[model samples]
Target: MSRICKPYAAIRTFLLLLCGWVPLLTALGAAGQTRIYDIRYGNNAIGTLETKQETTGSTRRITLKSRVQMKLLSRMEVDIFAEYRHNVLHAAKATRLQGKSSADSKETSTEKSANGYTVIRKGERSILHHARITYCVSDLYFTEPREIRQVYSETLGVLLPLKLAADKRYELTMPDGKRSYYRYEKGKLKEVEISHALGKAFFTAREGA
Candidate 1:
């Protein structure tokens, strides 16, 4: 992979998490919903993002998968799975892979603890001593943040501040200073514009979906 594409692994992970891309009707079930969104660069289609949510009794499980090929040069893929109980995060894992055959990989994991949660990344361990993680990045795909002010980023293993614009749009500023905008229509995510390491991209809802 080129040095330029190498730095994008982190940024792409964040962008994929922030945007919900799929142009299909939601498949509802007794346990959860499955949705997909299309990832684009300008007018060019580049990738897809899929999210699945399931519930069992009091536990809720969410999984997100994304694949992107930028300029036909490098490809990056990320998958995240999280479980929450009673609106509190219990455990989560996120994996990122880069290259044509997915030769390079990195992982971050979180687990509930007595106080807060334990985070492990690249084999190093850390601790987050906050209370409970009620809302996370994954929830953005399924629900609009009307009254939410903050959310936990499972990829970054940190809490990110979320703002509601006067236009009813949601805005998020990453730690690296990149900004992303999300718009919803009929309580569903319709569009997301994001600034990333490779410039700007968008995830828009597919028409007739």
Candidate 2:
């Protein structure tokens, strides 16, 4: 990881928590819907700024025919076809290949993706690796970004600031005006509260967006 990319990676981990635990909130619907967000925060020569958000509307449920792109290296690209449901997952043509980050100590495995999509084992009971896909490639030759989403049902309602009951309530923190705050509650969540340095913000899902 480059000095500049470390912070983004850290924030990406935070996003994993934010989205990974959303369903654990007791206030959530049994099989309502889930959001896989891509939120990030970091500091660079530009300055200190905070930006975090979750995928809204559609695009949350990557279904059987879902396919996304991954740029491997400069002038190179690989595609990721996501097919997941409940727990079991399978990739069409995913394979192990080396990457710039292949040499990194944190790398668990190397996957050379041509047209082959990768596989993610079923649920927390299965493999720990949820499948990491290289996102983009550039002339700068940076480590390609990957997505990590792990499911832990037993972990539900165990950790603080995490869940309520059976999809009852959930909590999270993100960039507000000045500072961000964690919002959590009990019972059905009519709305969610997000705290800021000055005050707080409330959000309600659109009826059917």
Candidate 3:
């Protein structure tokens, strides 16, 4: 009877090791190559959220964290974490034409990185493709009207509200047409009053919170 119990116990222990420990170990291995996020700026915002994202490299994997400071009219500062993800490869490898990128951090009056980003192995230390980074955003760019909001929308893959509708999701009728949709609030179309080069481009939210 004791021998029979021993085999069952061994089987249970083996299951525990396989189910519990292996994934944790793989995650630990992936950890070394993941992205790290931070709000590098925004404590003293000028007119709007003036934050930046940054990462430090070691050896295993690529890391990243997207942070923002919702600065409005040079008054309030709402520090927030927006989005993040990771693979073996870092952003540099995900969108770069040649050397390392400076788009993630180092705040200045200078323009955004045109080098693009990539997504390959952190161990590989290089990128494969080229995707341009956001170049510029105007004042009231975070929240404003449509005509002015198009710049921000374009960066986020949205079309102007005029040629496009705010009640449903569809492709942009603009030159850069793709599967775009109108975002919603509490069953009402939320409005984004932005400041853009073309005056004001209002992107209203749709019906649904």
Candidate 4:
């Protein structure tokens, strides 16, 4: 009877350990997954964007890479990296490369401090209060579908207010009163329509990719 009980108890402990680790493994797998999107403008394929997130314990990192060509003349590329702890962003960096040669590039970095944040762009420095920062080039709605009323723009260096619709659409009104709309389908972002001085441009995510 003692021998049988010993084996049973060992098996029970193993089972408990397996059960405890299953969810953690699944969460790690999900964090490592990547999503790619093809950007288009007026029936023409412009570029592609890839986004991924990594998590280790309570720390998370999100990265975005995008490359786009403009009318066969010059190409532009952008890379953004963001780090978060417990869902709050603590650091971020963005780099932009312009022209076909990629020689004309600019980099911007930000770090959070006890009081606020420090930003350095193209050798210029600035300080920000305790504000949440967001990148205008990246599609943040894809990762966080929650209704975000306002977001801080790292590029523009200001906080922008957004309007939300019942259909899971987000509208950002520019300082000049121009409006940009982000439409989602079934909680996933599908399209972004922008009305600006250049014209109305649409960015639709490729389906089944």
Query: TM-score of predicted model 4?
Result: 0.73
> Which structure among the candidates has the greatest TM-score?
1
lDDT of 2 by residue, 96-135 (tens): 1223443321211122234332223222222323342211
Predicted structure 4: lDDT = 0.56
Instruction: Please report the candidate that would top lDDT against the real structure.
Output: 1
Model 1: worst 10 consecutive residues (lDDT sum): 19-28
**Error in Å for residue 106 of model 1:** 0.7
Candidate 1 vs. true structure, TM-score? 0.84
**Model 3: what TM-score?**
0.20
TM-score of each: 0.84, 0.25, 0.20, 0.73
Cα lDDT for residue 190, model 3?
39
Order the candidate numbers by TM-score, best to worst. 1, 4, 2, 3
Q: CA shift at 161, candidate 3, in angstroms?
A: 7.8
lDDT of 1 by residue, 12-77 (tens): 746544322111122123256777889877567878888787777667788888888877466778
Q: How accurate is candidate 2 locally (lDDT)?
A: 0.23
- The per-model lDDT (C-alpha) reads 0.73, 0.23, 0.24, 0.56
Off by over 4 Å in 3: 1-149, 152-176, 186-209
Count the clashes in each prediction: 6, 19, 41, 0
lDDT of 3 at 177: 32
Question: What is the RMSD, in Å, between candidate 4 and the native fold over all Cα?
Answer: 19.3
